[model samples]
Target: MYRSHTCGELRISHIGNTVTLAGWVQTVRKFGSITFVDLRDRYGITQLLFGEELNKQLDENPLGREFVVQATGKVNERSSKNANIPTGDIELLVESFSILNKSAVPPFTIQDDTDGGDDLRMKYRFLDLRRNAVKKNLELRYAVNRSARNYLHENNFMDIETPFLIKSTPEGARDFVVPSRMNPGQFYALPQSPQTFKQLLMVSGYDRYYQIVKCFRDEDLRADRQPEFTQIDCEMCFVEQEDILNMFEGLIKRIFKDVKGIDYTEAVERMTWEEAMWQYGNDKPDIRFGMKLCNLKFPAHTFPAKESLSSLIAGDFAVFNDAETVIAIAVPGCAEYTRKQTDELTEWVKRPQIGMKGLVFIKCNADGTYKSSVDKFYSEEKLKAIADAAGAKAGDLVLILAGTEERTRKATSELRLEMGKRLGLRKADEFKLLWVLDFPLFEFALEDQDGGGAGRWVARHHPFTSPKPAHIETMINNSPKVADLDKYLEHPYAGIKANAYDMVLNGNEIGGGSIRIFQRELQEKMFAALGMDAEEQQHKFGFLLGAFEYGAPPHGGIAFGFDRLCSILGGSESIRDFIAFPKNNSGRDVMLDAPSEIAEKQFDELSIKLNLK
Candidate 1:
C-alpha cells in the first residue's frame, strides 16, 4: 500500500506506530543537519522530520515544494506542536522515502497567501485548489449540496435529470446555441433553467421534482453573473405560493444548520415588491442594516400611496423641482463630514455608472442645527424640514439624488448599497433572509421595440408566470397598447401584479419563482401581452401551451442560484471562488483554453461557415 494512514490522520495517540504516508510536499525547512517538511493531501497536512542521516539522502535527491513523495516512518509526538492543524500533535519520523513523481515548479505558490494574480491562479487552478483556503470553500459547497439533497429527498422531492440541449426560445438573456452536424443549418440551445421541462413534469403528474442542474445564457458577465451556472431547480404541482414559501424556507434553514451551524430559528421576513422599492429603493433589500430610502418627490403612478413633499423644492431649486424624482437616505453619524468628504460623495454620484448631475446634502449638526448644499435656495427652516422628512437625527447626514424617475431610483439604490458597504453594514457573515413578493407582471420594454417609436410590454419574469388572481381579468381584458409614450404607465396592464416571489439574502436575489399559468386561455393571453403573435408563440412554446390544456394542476417552483448561495454561505463575495475550474470574467477557461475555433473539416461537416463582422 502507498500509505497506511492519511497525512492528516496520525496523532499523539499513534506515537511509536510505524506507518506509511504519501502526499505532495507543502513546504520544506532546514535546521542545521535536521530537515522538516509539511506533507499535504486533500485531507490535511502533517509535519515530517528528517534526521541527520536522511539529510544526506535529501541532499543527493533534494525535495522541492509540491513534489509527490511516499514515506514510511514511525509516528512520533511533535517536539513543537502546531495548534492550528489537526495532526499538529504528532510527526512522522522518516526511516525511508521515495519520490512518487517529480513536478516542474508551479507558476504560483500553492499557498493560501500565494503571490499570484487571478489569471495566473486560474491558469494553475489545479495547483490553487490545493491551498487550504480554496479547499475549505469547496468543502463548504459540498456540505451545502449534501444538506440540500438530504432535505429535498426527505420532503419527497425526486432528483430528476433534464436535457442540456433543447430548442432555442430566447426570452430574458441570449441563448448559447450549438450547431447540429446531422441536421445541417439547425442548432440546439442549451437549457437556461429547464423551465419548460419542469412545468411539463408538473403536468405529467410528477408532484415534486428537483435537480441540481447546469444552465447557460449568453449574457454580459458581472461579479455575480456567469455565462454558465448551476441552479437548485425545483417544481411542485397542486401547491400554492404559501406551500412553496414554507417548503423552501425549510430547505434554506436546514442548509444553514447543517452547513453553517446556524439554527436560524427566527422566521424569514416578507415584503411586497412595492414596499421593498419604497423603503429600500431595491426589491432585494439587505435588512441587516437600516438605511431605507426616503422618497421626497416621486411620480404619482410609481407609488400611489406615497405622498410627496413637493414643498421642499417649492423654492424653485430647479435641480430638485424639475427632476421627475427626488430621493434621499440618512447616513448615521456623518453630520461632521468636511466639505472634502461631502464633495467626494458628490463626485461618487456623478460618475458615469451613477449618472447623476449633482448631489444635495443636509447635515443635521450635533447641536440640532442643519447645514445644506442648497442653503442658497432654502432657508434654515426649509432645510430642517427636509432633514426631518428624511428621518435625519442629530449628527446625521442626509444624501439626496434627483433625476429621471428610473435613473434616479436606480442611482439612489446603488448609493444606498455603497454607503452600506462603506459603513460595513453589508456583512457577508450576517445573513438576513427576506421574500420580496408581488412584482409587476409586465415591465415596459420600449427599447426592445424594432422601430424605436414606442416600447412594448414584456414579461417581468416570463410569459409562463400567472397573474395575481384579482388581476387575471385585468390582463386578459385590456390590450397591451401604449397609445402615447408618456402615458405608458396609465395602461391597464401596467399595474397588474404577478403571483411571483424572490428570496433575497443580504441584498442579493438568491432565488425566484412564480405560480405558473395553468390555463391555456390565460397562458395565451400572457403570450399575446408579450407581443408574441400566434405563429411565433406556436413556434417557440406550442408544446408548453398544449400541455397546459391537458389538465395541468396548479403548480409553482423556485430555482436558487446554487453558486451564489454557496458563496454567501462561505462568506465570500465572488462566486468564482466557490466554483472549481470556473471561467474568467470574460467567460474564458484559461486552463482548458475553451471556446476556441474548430477545424475547417468539422465546420464543413456541419455545413457552416464563419462570417466575422
Candidate 2:
C-alpha cells in the first residue's frame, strides 16, 4: 500500500502506532542535525521529524518544496504543536524515507498568501490549486454540488443529460459556433442552456428533470461571467409560478444549511422589476444595506405615476433645466465631507465607466441648514426640500447625478454601490436574497440586424417565456410594431409583464426562470412579436412548436448559475476562484494558450475558409 494513513489523518490518539504516509513536501526546515518537513496532501498537512542519519540523507538528496515522498514513521506527540492545523498536536518521527519524485522549483509559492501576479498564477494553475485559499474554494464548490444533488434527489428531480451541440437561436448573446465536418457549409452552436431540451423533457412527461449542464455564450466577459459556464438547469410540468418559487427557495435554503451551516431562516425578499429599478436603479440590487434611488426629474413615461421633485431646481440652474432626469442617493453620516472630498467624488463620477459630466451634492447639516453645489440656482429652502425628497436626514450627504434617463439612472446606481463599498456596508459575509419579479415581457430593440426592430419587439428574458396571465390577451391582440419611435413605451406591448423571476443574492443575479408559453397560438404570437415569421419560427423552434401539440402540460422551471452561486456562497467577488480552470477575462486559457490557430487540413475537411479582416 502507498500509505497506512493520509498526511492529515493521524493525531495524538495514534501516538503509539507506526504509520506510512505519502504526500508532497510543503516545506523543509533544518536545525543542526535534525530536519522538519511539512507533508501536505489533499486531506491536510502533517509535520515530520528526521534524525541525524536521515538528515545526512537529506544532504546527499535535499528535500525541496513540492517533492513527492513516502515515509514510514512512528507517530509521536509534537514538542512544538502547531495550533493552526488539525494534525498539529502530533508529528511523525520518521524511521525511514524515500524520495519518489523531485519537483522543479514552483513558479509561485504554494501557500495561502502566495507571491504571484494573476497572469503568473493562471499560467501555473496546478500549483495555484495547491494554495489553501484556492483549495478551500474548490472544496466549498464540491460541498455545494453534493448538497444540491442530494436535495434534488430527495425532491424527486431526476438528473438527465442534455446535448452540447444544438441549433443556434441567438437571443440576448451571440453563440459560439462549431463547424460540422459531416454537414459541410453548416455549423452547430453550443447550448447556451438546456432551455429548450428541458422544456421538451416536460413535454415528454418527465414532470421533474434536472441537469448540471455546460452552457456557452459568445458574450462580453466580466468578473461574474464566462464564455462557458455551468448551470443547475431544471424544469417541471403541472406547476405554476408560485410552485416553482417555493420549490427552489427550499433548494437554496437547503444548500445554505448543508454547505455553509447557515440556516437562512428569513424569507427571501421580493420586488417587482419596476420597483427594483425605481427604488435601487438595479434589477440585482445589493440589499445588505439600503440606499434606494430617489427620482427627482425622471421621464414621466417610464414611471408615469411616480411623483417627481423636478420643480425643486427648475428656474435658474441651466444644468438641471437642460438635463432630462435627476437621480440621487443619501449616504449616511457623510455630511461633514470637506470640499476636496466632494470634488474627488465629482471626478469619480466623471470617469469613463460612470460617464457623467459632474456630480451635485446637498449636505443636510445637523444645524437645520442645507449646503449644496447648486446653491447659486436655488434657495436654502429648495435645497432642504430636495434633500428631504431623497430621504436624507440630518448629517447625511445627498449625491445627485443628472443626465439623460438611462445613463443617469445607471450612474446613480454605480455611485450608490461605491459609497456602500466605501462605508463597508456591502459585507461579504452578510448575504441577502431577493426575488425581482414582473419583468416586462418584451423589450423594444431600437433596431435589429435583419432590418426588423426599432420598430419591433424582442423577448426580455427569452422567446418562450409566458406573459402574465392578465396580459395574454393584450399580447395576442397587439401588433407589436412601433409606429412612432419616441412613443414606443406607449404601446400596449410595452406594458405586458412576463411570468419571469430572477433570484438575486447580495447584488448578483444567481438564478432566473419563467412559466413557459404552452399554447400553440400564444407561442406563435410571441414569435411574431419577436419579428420571427411563420417560416423563421419553423426553421428555429419547429420541434418545440410541434411538441406543444402532444398534450404539453402547464410548466415552469429555473436554472441557477452554478459558478456564480458557488462564488457568492464562498464570499468571492469573482467566479473564477471557484472554477477549476477558468479562462481569463478575455476568455483565453493562458495555461493552455488556447484559441490558437487550428490545422488548415481540419478547416478544409469542414469546408471552411477564414477571412481574417
Alpha-carbon RMSD of each model: 1.5, 1.3
TM-score of 2: 0.98
Q: Candidate 2's C-alpha lDDT?
A: 0.91
User: lDDT for each of the candidates?
Assistant: 0.90, 0.91
Q: Model 2: residues >4 Å from true position, as ranges?
A: 449-453
Give me the candidate number with maximum TM-score. Answer: 2
Tens-digit per-residue lDDT, 71-121, candidate 1 = 999999887999999999999999999999988998888888899899999
lDDT of 2 by residue, 81-165 (tens): 8999999999999999999999999988899889999999999998898888999999999998999999999999999998888
Error of 2 at 509 (Å): 0.5
* Pairs clashing within candidate 2: 446-454
RMSD of 2: 1.3
